[model samples]
Target: MHTTTKTSPIETKDLVQKTVFPILFSISFAHLLNDLIQAIIPSVYPILKENYHLSFSEIGLITFAFQLTASLFQPFVGYYTDKYPQPFSQIYGMLFSLAGIIALSFADNFYMILISVMLIGTGSSIFHPESARVSYLASGGKRGLAQSIFQVGGNFGTALGPLLVALIVVPNSQKYILWFIIAAIIGLGIISKIAFWYRDHLVLRTNQKKEIVAYHDLSKGKVNWAIAILLIVIFSKFFYSACLSTYYTFYVIDKFHLTIKQAQFHMFIYLIAYAAGTILGGPLGDKIGRKYVIWFSVFGATPFALLLPYVSLFWTDVLMVVIGIIISSAFPAILVYAQELLPKKLGMVSGLFYGFAFGMGALGSAFLGKLADVTSIQYVYQVCSFLPIIGAICYFLPNLKKK
Candidate 1:
């Protein structure tokens, strides 16, 4: 009887270390809905450009406005939430997105579109940091796998957006964006459930007075330098990604002489490959090392990206898929690596990385848009093809894995 009693605590501890897949998958589903609604913004950009008769520069500004709001407030939100966690905060984000969708569906002018996208971006800022925290909390020591599942949801959401837009909104008018509100409504319910679980989990954690600490041998200076290197890698990856996500549809249309719907379908294929890569990156990082995955994911795509500009139409599609998979794999590994670097500061670290990523994407979209206007979409690809070379710096990042 004494032995049974003594083993109970050890058993409980073991259970705590086991991955909580139900929570992980539930939160992932919520992430899917949240990002699906957010994806509506960029998915409809071509439509917005045509309807408003806007210039490429104006389209860039719209991306700038959306991503600026999305990027600027995330770190603060994460910082605040780190000190004072909010279980239901994602629900608030959903409401903002709902409002944004309604506003966007009716928007007849460029300024209105900007306002709508900003609102949606604000919701994104709130959703990501907190949701990432939730993933961390529920990870049960499988941090890489947890982050991958969380990220894959968002990637799938992002991929689905263009396909849905091509089917629903592309054939019709902009007012069809209202259909996205259904997703927002569904997200609210899922998030609320997750919030209840998070609240209970927090209470349990507080009661137990248990904390998780990840110790590494690296110095603070080395950690900071490593972080900077990761950010630079993020800048390279997303800057190049922005060229495709924001302008690839147009690029394909111009280069292949395809219709907008056909172009979106091509973009959908790339995004689907991106989602598939995201699925691979996280678990592979757990098995191998994040540094290795980061090194390969970014630099490995360089050859494909450099060749994409000169490829035939069929080859361009194939190259885009290859580049998407290779490059997209880096983010989950990079993010999980950062989280491991600053394990205690989960919210702040998550926010900072996500915020910086969005900032880079915004800058890339705006810069590439203007560049596309100045030269041509094909030229933008030629310039961006070199960005992935920046991944070679991954050599400097210290491996967090123990021997």
Candidate 2:
């Protein structure tokens, strides 16, 4: 006698043609948890500095260690995964992060801290490319909105990190960082479920007819040129962003003499605006063309970013919101544009952009830390303010919407 087997309801539909909200949100929430855990490293910087009596240079080195490990491994991971997709791989990433978190909580020396963050960074390197591929697969052709949903969760998590650090780890002992392991546990459970869905989805796809592939009309050389320009734009955006994200609290503390908690609140406000901007970026890109959003998101922030350093505390806070909104929108649009440019290489494209962004932010943090050591925090802002001006080059990119 033959046995009958049951299939999931999702398998009945052409998943490529239908937006999978459940999976999109599941992966997005997983992204949120993943980034939240990662954000702990930056959020606890003040604490780390105070505890260890670390210089700005040392602080920057810590960030460098973490981001270097995170950035360097991603492209290789994406390339390998493209050939052999691993549905449960994110679980291993989470385990690495968990180990890092435990190590960080108990870390005694500077080198130990470096090693711990490097482990966490490794997990991040593993997480982003795969999660991004899952987002693309679940997009149902609404790539922008899907990526936005996936991205916004991470932005929101990043916003929460500083606030949580202020409330939890800052006022208390460094050992309190162990509290974050709960986030890891929850993330592991979520990614495990996502892995099952991912496995089933792969099986379904193998059994189904081939899906239509998308193409861009630009020549390979033009495509390569466009990619190079996008990387330049990424450098412009993320490097400046690193200055704010890594040092804004110190800037405010030095400039305005605010306490750590107060400065953290301010950081939370700016990051909240950053997260809100991510929501509008993707859907707007779908409607008005990603090139326009990319151009506007990057260059449009120039005036505001330029004015930020010279303003009063009140105006500085206001400009943070404005700059956050405008600048944060560029990434979603940029990633989706690159993915469309090389539709067949989603994993590679995502890994490259994400890795490059992390690398730029790391270099910015490290270099600016040394700069701040030599000059001042305010000087770092003045130098970084010019970065967004590079966005003017976006005018040269071909309009994908025209085809």
Candidate 3:
């Protein structure tokens, strides 16, 4: 007679430190690289507009192409990463990103520019699934803090990318594209070494068969109420993030009547505060639980966002820093929450929360821009304030518990 035995899930403390740490580091660094591309363009849009004589709609289309690719490709990548070895996917993605950056340097027409952006978007899409899956599997049960650290790296990149562009690319935009190519070459060398090391250490047992799962297997009725709640939270956060990413710099310059340098100073302060918030939010979520951290952030952020449109120039800068901290804090908590709700589907969950929410936010950007055109830009802030208020209300919904 044969008996089947069920294996228990691994304990959090029993996780391998070597595998966990490196996976986290790699994902975080990859995030930084991906975001560096995103950050540079917005800061230098004025330069691009002047050089190309582009319309606002044309610029919006460029952003739309970049975001739409990342958004739509996420599920496909998530499905494949689950069933395949992921190290090569990440390396290849970075290579594609590098190619895109190089292409951007020599892009003469709008079509070439859109092609470059699409390549970058394709590269970025690959990273979300591959890195996120590895990080979740490696982290065992201490997933929240682990995910947080990974996210903070991207936030740090988002903060630093603009500053780096300001210092380097702004002076000579064409020359900086070469810098991306050089960086790509260096990245290829590093990735090759890492891949070789990973392969050397890999142990495949003759007796053990690899398990392959389909996307439908992962998605069937595994939906938790917590996930639905978390999606709403993500939707709300994306609205604010879209405003900040696409229009905040422009808004600050126009609304407050400040020079470029003055607006940039405010942008830097807000970015720093945002980065700090992400860093702190993760550990706090792990300590206090995702529910509390998320709610607190939304509640805290709403008033500050409301105050943003009404304050004086100096006070608005201070208000933005405060609002940045509050909104940024909620993101890591949301990421962790979604991952927890879908442990077996980390890549899809992360992709849904991060990629979909971001895409939706990018879509929202066009709507907000139109709102800014018809109504006052201050009304955009009014719309921003409502998102968190709705998020906070949803956060308290009874269905949020695991069901």
lDDT-better candidate, 2 vs 3 = 2
* Top-TM-score structure, candidate number: 2
Residue 360 lDDT in model 1?
Answer: 94
Arranged by lDDT with the best first, the candidates are 2, 1, 3
lDDT per residue, candidate 1, 1-403, as tens digits?
Answer: 3553333544545545668888899888888888888788888988888888989998889999988988999999999999999999998988998999999999999889999999999999999999998887788877889999999999999999999999999999999999988899889988988999889777656644366567787899999999999999999998988898999999999988999899889989999999999999999999899999999999999999999999898999899889988988899999999988988888899999999999999999999989989999999999999999999999998999755
- The clash numbers for all candidates, in the given order, read 0, 0, 0
Candidate 3 residue-wise lDDT, 292-389, digit = tens = 88888876787777777777888977887788887888877777666655555766776776678758766767677667767766677767766777
What's the distance in Å from true for residue 208, model 3?
A: 9.3
Which residue ranges in model 3 land beyond 4 Å of their true spot? 1-19, 186-222, 375-379, 397-403
Scored against the true structure, residue 348 in model 1 reaches a CA lDDT of 91
Which runs in model 2 stand beyond 4 Å of their true positions? 1-13
| TM accuracy, model 2 | 0.97
lDDT score for candidate 2 against the true structure: 0.91
lDDT of 2 by residue, 1-403 (tens): 9997865545545655678999999998988898999989988888888888999999899998999988998988888888899899999999999999999999988999999999999999999999999988888888889999999999988998899999998888889999999999999999999999888777776666665667878899999999999999999999999999999999999999998889999999999999999999999999889999999999999999999989999999999999999999989999999999998888889899999999998998999999999999999999889899999999998888733
Q: Where's the lowest-lDDT run of ten residues in candidate 1?
A: 1-10
Give per-residue lDDT, candidate 1, residue 295. Answer: 97
